[model samples]
Target: MKVGVVTFPGSLDDGDARRAVRLAGAEPVALWHADADLRGVDAVVLPGGFSYGDYLRCGAIASFAPVMGEVVAGAQRGLPVLGICNGFQVLCESHLLPGALVRNDHQKFVCTDQRLRVESTATAWTSAFEAGAEITVPLKNGEGGFVADAETLDRLEGEGRVVFRYLGANPNGSLRDIAGIANERGNVVGLMPHPEHAVEAGYGPGTDGLGLFASVLGAGLAAVGA
Candidate 1:
């Protein structure tokens, strides 16, 4: 499987995301923000970092990038897309997923190994995990808080769209401790944690995050019966 990792001007973890994809037994396709094409990749990843210097708001500027146009369309067609950290912000800004990410309650950048529970395993990126399973991954961001209106929150909960939830403690004050979420179609997902950074056992947080990448790869291969 070929997974495209998009790099916008201030993207910091694009390389890490590419490495994680390769480690998960898939090819990583490098994509640029200025490009409008998807290069025939099976899936797409929007890695973390402050895009456009987070000027207006985190991911506000990047949501309008040329590459995102293709991404939005691909996601609508059920092409798997994973957005991490600031990339998650972009996904929300693009309306690919509902809700908004805001400043951390502490008003400070936080970095740590956070415990999360798998709330839903039906998404393209999380099928490998069993519901209610606990996993730890690196979490780092300044504006990582997730927010939504009561009706939207109720719909997400009612529809089982919540993907990941904070386990031990809420790191960013996200509503209901939601760390990640998926679209209604389960093809597009956004999360604030850095799973790519935890794919390698000795290098980053740990190997706990490998399953996220593997899950998507497996789902893709299954679709092709490979």
Candidate 2:
């Protein structure tokens, strides 16, 4: 499988995302934010970083990027997309996923190895995880809080769309300890923790994050028509 990693201005983890994709047994394609095309990759990853210097708001400016046009369309067409950290903010800003990311409860940048529970594995990116399993990944951000209206929150809970939830401490005080969520179609996913950072053992807490990247390539996807 060929996975494309998009690089927006000020993107810091695009290279890490590419390496994660490659390690997951897929070809990694470099995509520019200015480009309007998706290059026909099977999937796409919007890596973490402060795009446009977080001007206006985190991911507010980047939601309007040229390549996001194709990303939006591809998402509608069932293309798998994973958004990490700042990229998660971008996904919310673009209306690809419901809710909004705001300032952390601590009102400061927090960085640590956060333990997360795999709540749902129905999405294209999380199919490799066992439900209720716990894994740790790097979480670093200043505006990583996730929130939405009560009704929406209830719906997400009822539909089992909450993908990843904080296991031990709520690092950024995200609602319900949500670390990640998936769209209604289960194709687009937004994760606050940096899974890309944990793909290599020597460089991170563990290789626990590899399953998310490899999930898309898992054989069970075709059985479910993913």
Candidate 3:
């Protein structure tokens, strides 16, 4: 299986995402933000970074990038897509997912090993994790607070779209302690945490993040075998 990691201007974790994919036993393909094609990868990951310098509103500008056009279309077609940190902002900006990420309630950048509870294993990126499992991963961002209207928040919770929730304390004041969420189809997932940074042992928090990459790769293999 092959997973495509997108690299946008100022992207910092594309390499880490690719490495995570390779570590999960799948081929990693580099995707440029300016490109119009997806290279036919089995799944796609939007790595964390300040795309386009985060000029307009976090991921506001990068949402209009040429490559995102294809990503949006592909995601709508049931292609698995994972967005981490800044990439999560991009997903929201592109309207592929709902809600928005705002400045942290503390109004400062935060970086730490965050504990997250897997609320739902229905998404492509989270299927390997057991429901209600707790995992620690690195999270770093300035505007990582997730916000949505009451209806939207209620809908997300009611529909089981809330994928990951903060375990101990709310790191960024995200509503309902939501660390991650998925689309209606459970194919597109966006999270404020950096799972890629935790995929390797003796590196980050631990290898807990590997489950996300493994989930998608295993799903791709199953599809092919089917």
Clash counts for all predictions: 0, 0, 0
Q: Show model 1 residue runs off by greater than 4 Å.
A: none
Cα displacement (angstroms), candidate 3, residue 181, comes to 0.2
lDDT of 3: 0.95
TM-score of 1: 0.98
Question: Tens digit of lDDT per residue, candidate 1, span 1-226?
Answer: 9999999999999999999999999999999999999999999999999999999999999999999999999999989999999999999999999999999999999999999999999999999988999999999999999999999999999999999999877998999999999999999999999999999878876888988899999999999995
How many backbone collisions does model 3 have?
0
Q: What TM-score would each prediction reach against the true structure?
A: 0.98, 0.97, 0.99
True-vs-predicted CA distance for residue 123, candidate 2, Å: 0.5
- Residue-wise C-alpha lDDT for candidate 2, range 1-226, written one tens digit per residue: 7889999999999999999989988889999999999898888899999999999999999999999999999999989999999999999999999999999999999999999999999899898999999999999999999999889899999999999999877888899899999999899999999999999879899999999899976733474584
What C-alpha lDDT values do all the predictions have? Answer: 0.95, 0.92, 0.95
